[model samples]
Target: MLVLFVLAFGLFAILNPRVFLNPINLQNMMVASPEVGILAIAMALAMLTGGIDLSLVAIANLSAITVSTMFTAIASSDPATAESLGGFIALIGVLVGALAGAVNGFLIATVGITPILATLATMQIFNGIAIVWTGGKTLYGAPAVLSSVGQATVGGIPILFLEFLVVAVLIGVLISRTPFGRRTQLQGANPTAAMYSGIRSTSVLYGTYVTTGLLGGIAGLVFLSRNPTASADYGTSYVLLVIVIAVLGGTNPTGGFATITGVVLATLVLQVVQSGFTAIRLSAYEYAIAQGVILIAVMVFDQVRVRRRPRRAPSSQTETIALAEIPRA
Candidate 1:
């Protein structure tokens, strides 16, 4: 998939070097990628555990909005305290996200609710809370320090992109190299076997959702920093997009299989395609349509492939009789 993406990107750059290959355009593409990329990774984790998180973007928005409101209130009351809080705003956003994830975990793990229904309900609840808190208005004027992460560059690389890279590496290690990751895979692949093996399935599920929430929160904070504004309706279409990315990156929808490398590379491909569309002056709706088509096609292909696999039949009477005769001889 990465190879295909590289080929497509090369073709585009060759076709329109002035636009697609331009340094500024590349930097802008990187800047645009991190939020969705981060969310996609978070979504990948959930899928690996045989579940989905429909509320990630909602969590992100709520966290960012909450932190933004806190900062605004503090700044209005005491300049010095607000200044100190600015540095801690990101951490506070992550905590908010983790708390939201805990709610999801409790509902699904403790209350015995299905993951899909649980997250679906939470999605609406979180979105409603955000709307009520923000009163359907956008909050702006975050601290300059927080904004710098989105605006500043290191060695011509966007800091947001760098942050994403760090996160991807950490998550990749967690999923591919850690014992916890192995347990998660086992739980997703065969819950009965995992439980029988003394694996605490409930704990794994809780951890997975919480980690997802943390990532969502970080992405939300990044979005807030990038735009320096908080809105209740931010990234309204991202939940589906992240799901598509995760599936495309080889995170099995049925669970028990995923690759962080695939997720990161897939994100780059999408971002490149997005930038390519802009270079050629394509409409934004076209991008959404293309993504939808790709997602549907991939799902269809997976279903077909699964259905095409050979099936094993039960033992026939002739084979059973032959085996019985041999044993008697």
Candidate 2:
């Protein structure tokens, strides 16, 4: 996937060096990516546990909407009061996300609902709440600090991109090094075996969902910062896009395997394609079609790979030993 991303980028750069390789264009690509990229990582985490978070985008929008509403209300009466509490408002958004995630965890983990059905139901619920909160309108005029966070750069790197990078590293370490991550993999691979081994499956599931919610909330913050607006329907297309990116990044649909590195590379690849399409004046529908095709192709390839893998055969010595241990007729 990394090689594919590199090749695709090189091809684009070759085809239109004036735009594709232009510094401003490259920066724009990076800046536009963090929202979807962050959501993709969150999706990957859920998929690693043999579950899918269909409500992630909804959660993000809800979180952002909640915070933005408060900011707007305060700013209308006291702009200085709102400005002084920018960081606090952002934290509240994240907490709301966490609370939303906990709801999902309770439903799927504690209540024993199927993950897909549970998250699907929550997605609508969250989205509805957001729409109701804002009367289907957009909220803007946040603090200047948020605007700076959204647009500021250090050493030419967008702060949002830096946040994404930091999250990627943290999640990578969590999945690759932590006990909870190990248990998640084990549970996904074989829930019965993991339970029998004394792993707290409930804790693992709850933790995974909560972590996903946290990521979604953080992504919401960045999204709102970038646009300085919160809308109930913002990023509606991202739900499917993040899932596609997660699958393409080597997060198994059946669970038990995932790679943050693959997720990052795949995100870059898609972003490159998206940027190129934009440069050529492609419509949003075209982008959706491209994503749908990519998703189908990746799923088909995964099925083919699984089918082609050789099954383990018993060794001659093991077979003989088994035969010897059998009771005499």
Candidate 3:
């Protein structure tokens, strides 16, 4: 991933040095990356558990719509009160995302529905709710403070980009330092073994989806802050883009592996490619075609790497052998 990022950056720098290397263009990439970067993190989390959350973008839209509507309504009646409670309202928006996640968790963990199917149904349901709430129109305006913070900068770094970094670091720590993260990976790798080892697969799955939901919610808030508008159909293409980011970031689509660092690097790579495309005046369709090609190439490379790699004894077999070697207690 690092190599890919460096190569992409260098190539773009060579092709469009003036525009690609411009400070303004770089800042734009930083600002634009968070919405998709954060969502990519969420998607990576789901993939870590051998599941996918197709409703993530829907959850984000719903959360953003909820926030936008509340802010607009409150600000319309009592601007002072709305200003005072802007933070609270934003928190509520994030909670809305968590609630949506809980719904997905329930359907998958409690109801035993397939992850894809459950999330697909909920995606429509969530989007439908957003449309009904907004009458299929865009809800514009957010707290002045929120928008300011979203667009703020410090030492040439975008506040939104900083937030994305914080999120990525925190998630990286959670996966690397926490027992739940270990359990999640284990569950994805071998559900039966995780069960035998007393891991509550259902709870893990539920928590996984909820966490992803929460992340989605955060992404939604960021989206609303950056754009100051919400609609049921906003970021409709992000679903696939995030998946591509996750996969390119070294996340296993089938589960049991993910890397926050890889995801971050992949995000940068895509951002550079995108900004480069714009600099070179490539059409959106061409950019999309490039994305598809990148995804396919990465998948093929991963397949080859896995195939050429030596397989190790299954952990279960290794554990059994070790247990057999031990004396009776």
Per-residue C-alpha lDDT of model 2 across residues 168-236, encoded as one tens digit per residue: 999999999999889999888888999999998889999999999999999889888888899999998
Pairs that collide in candidate 1 are none
- Model 1, 1-329: lDDT tens digits are 57758876997898789999999999998899999999999999999989999999999999889778888988898977887878797688889999999999999889989999999999999999999998999998676777888988999999999999999999999998998999999988988999999999889999999999999999888888788899989999898889989988889888898998888888888888788888888888998887777667667887899999988776798688878788552
What C-alpha lDDT, on a 0 to 100 scale, does residue 6 get in candidate 3? 92
Displacement of the residue 109 alpha carbon in candidate 3, Å:
0.5
Q: Estimate TM-scores for all models.
A: 0.90, 0.92, 0.94
Off by over 4 Å in 1: 296-329
Which residue pairs come into collision in candidate 3? none
lDDT of 1 at 126: 98
Show the lowest summed lDDT stretch of 10 residues, model 3: 142-151
Model 3 scores a TM of 0.94
Find the 10 residues in a row with the least total lDDT in model 1. Answer: 320-329
Predicted structure 1: lDDT: 0.89
- Hey, what RMSD does candidate 3 come out at? 2.7
C-alpha RMSD of each candidate structure in angstroms: 4.2, 2.5, 2.7
lDDT-based ranking: 3, 2, 1
